[model samples]
Target: MNNFSSPKIILLEGIVNESGSLHFFEYSEALPFSIKRSFWITEVPQGGKRGVHAHKKETQVLVALKGSVKVSLEGTSGSKHEFILDQPNKALILPAMFWSEVTFDKDTVLLVLSDQEFLESDYIRDKNEFDEY
Candidate 1:
């Protein structure tokens, strides 16, 4: 798909009370796709990287749970974008066919929600392969 759009960042609804704060997500209201798998990235060393690939049929949303994260994306049309996720209430939506690179700050914990399950055929891990995808 050459008509890929930019990544979207949506603010999730949160409630703050005298005790603490709570944030929740529902597929019908918060995400564009239903969640089929979920995971987290944590204990990343300084200057480390993750997500140096693109999914062919999976859409994902990343939420920073502890620290900050920087996400860089490149589309098939050669467009590039960058975003910062520093709040748990904020979610970054990543559609398929976009190469992504993620950098984490100290103690950063990133929660990833995906619309598809793990499939080796769904991943494009090389930049050249992704460009030709």
Candidate 2:
């Protein structure tokens, strides 16, 4: 995992896998805040990319299910680090203010859990202005 100061990025473990039964775990015990929405990305192109922005108040957890993905974390000082997520049970917790980009190796399924719903004003898309902020 990459070390981050402002928006703490943590790798979470212990995700269950069932053969025949389907179970839904409560997010109240695991997360600090309630989960407002849930979404997943499964059909990403080989050379495609996503999430080249940062949120001001939202926190997220990303998981790689099928293939692998390289997450680049950009700081305000132009410092950067990359993390490869391949395991189904592992997740990366991303806080606000950290610029992130996702690049998939082959067809990848990326699951994202958010603390809030979709809000356009919360996003900082410009990389230069994102670095300045």
Give the winner by lDDT.
Answer: 1
Scored against the true structure, residue 113 in model 2 reaches a CA lDDT of 78
Q: Candidate 2, which ten residues in sequence have the lowest lDDT sum?
A: 1-10
lDDT of 2 by residue, 27-124 (tens): 44345667676788877888678899988778887888679898988766677778788876567777777799999878798888788899999999
Off by over 4 Å in 1: 1-5
- How does each model score on TM-score? 0.93, 0.78
Error of 1 at 49 (Å): 0.3
The C-alpha stretches of model 2 lying farther than 4 A from their native spots are 1-30
Residue 1, model 1, lDDT: 21
| lDDT assessment of candidate 2 | 0.74
Residue-level lDDT tens digits of model 1 in 14-132: 89899999998985544656678999999998778999999987888899998999999999999898999999999998988899999999999999988888999999999999998
How high is the CA lDDT of each candidate model?
A: 0.88, 0.74
Clashing pairs in 2: none
Provide C-alpha RMSD values for all models, in order.
2.4, 4.2
lDDT of 1 at 79: 88
